[model samples]
Target: MAGAAPILETRDLTIRFGGHVAVDGVSCAFERGTLTAIVGPNGAGKTTYFNLISGQLRASAGAVLLKGAPITRLAAPARARLGLGRAFQLTNLFPNLNVLENVRLAVQARAGTGLDFLSMAARRRDLAARAEACLARVRLAERAHASAAALSHGDQRKLEVAILLALEPDIFMFDEPTAGMSVDEVPVILDLIEAIKREGDKTVLLVEHKMDVVRRLADRVIVLHNGALVADGEPAAVVASPIVQEAYLGIRTAP
Candidate 1:
């Protein structure tokens, strides 16, 4: 799964909250154009690592590098400018707006264009096209005119993907993408993610609890336990590790 130069790297990344170390001196290289899934038991420092990489949480020590360049100092918004995009653990959407409108706003934001220009059709033509393309990519183009609130949970999840697509980021970090979807909705959202992974040559770092989703979409799996890396390698190999079975699957590693 790892190929080309690393798009992001953490050199002994560490963080501490008082006496608790949330993420220890962990070093990792996330390559470009691959999907890497991070999994573990609860409190495995999964989201914590995401915050550290995206600059949402400042590291107590160590650095984050993008394309071999240090970006550990950049704020989340600043990192977005450099092609790092994150879909929050919670859904962020404008319910009143139609599906297209929601993603169009993202497209405009990515261009750094002011909303005041939204009334100018000619000025918005390009943005409108780009937004539509994003919708198409996420398979929501047919519902472009529908109110966002009217969409099903699965569609809303896909809409969020469209919004992320509009950002045109090179690296995408997802925190629990299937969290709130219903059982049926889970497969739909998972399929959408798989489609995106298949269609693009983008780098994706995902934190997912659904073992089924992880098994299908991940090129590799990285396991975290007690705020430190416990496993990292191909999905099958890592998932079969006795340490992972003990920590997450409760299989209990032999004493």
Candidate 2:
């Protein structure tokens, strides 16, 4: 990761939906090759912030920068080409496609090659190899041929992550990667996140509701309340802060 700059930054970012503010004057940086988490309660503007950063929703005000250059004007695919990737809280896989083909399409999309027919998609040798690598990274190699709809909720989440990984992004933004997973699936999702941080050269920004996962994986934690950042710091310190506790826990008496 040498010579790599900060992959993403938001300067005084703000967003609105028909006169209602969703993210207000938020500013943060996601550095290259690190894992960070965003934690907040419902309507805390987590997903809205993600949408602004990933180019799905345009910011009403402020700048989104990639490598210190303004990217606020870029579209989602344009941002992806600049090495930004995102996974949704809701599963965003192609239900009709089998696992390999799903991932292969992502790889092909990122590679910017001309489209291939399904019959010849398997023969595109390089795309299949890259797709297999991504699936293997997420421990989904055994399920490569299964229809995506046939996989469990957890496997679908992993597949989503794997598909994004195939993009070879410098920054990976995950919105609640474990949203609908069972208890047993939590560790698998966590392990995949850990592996991305450990082995991939990607900077990760996760917005998660689960405090346990937030505590375990986050290098820095940012807490949002009422569309504003209320806490940002090392995970333990941020969690223990009175502001964070009050904002999310509603604790009034001294414990």
Model 1, total clashes: 0
Question: Per-residue lDDT for 3-66 in model 2, tens only?
Answer: 6557788988999888888999998877777798998889989999999999999999999999
TM-score to native of every candidate shown = 0.87, 0.92
lDDT of 1 by residue, 1-255 (tens): 345568889989999999999998889998777899999888889999999998899999999999989998889888888888887776678999999999888888789885474477446789999999999877789999999999987788888878888987888888898887778657656776776677667889999987878889999999989889889999989889998899878798777
Clashing pairs in 2: none
**Evaluated with lDDT, which candidate comes out highest?**
2
* Reference-based lDDT, each prediction: 0.86, 0.88
RMSD to the hidden true structure, all candidates:
2.7, 2.6
Model 2, 3: alpha-carbon shift in Å?
A: 11
Which segments of model 2 are wrong by more than 4 Å? 1-5, 115-119, 253-255
Q: Give the TM-score of candidate 1.
A: 0.87
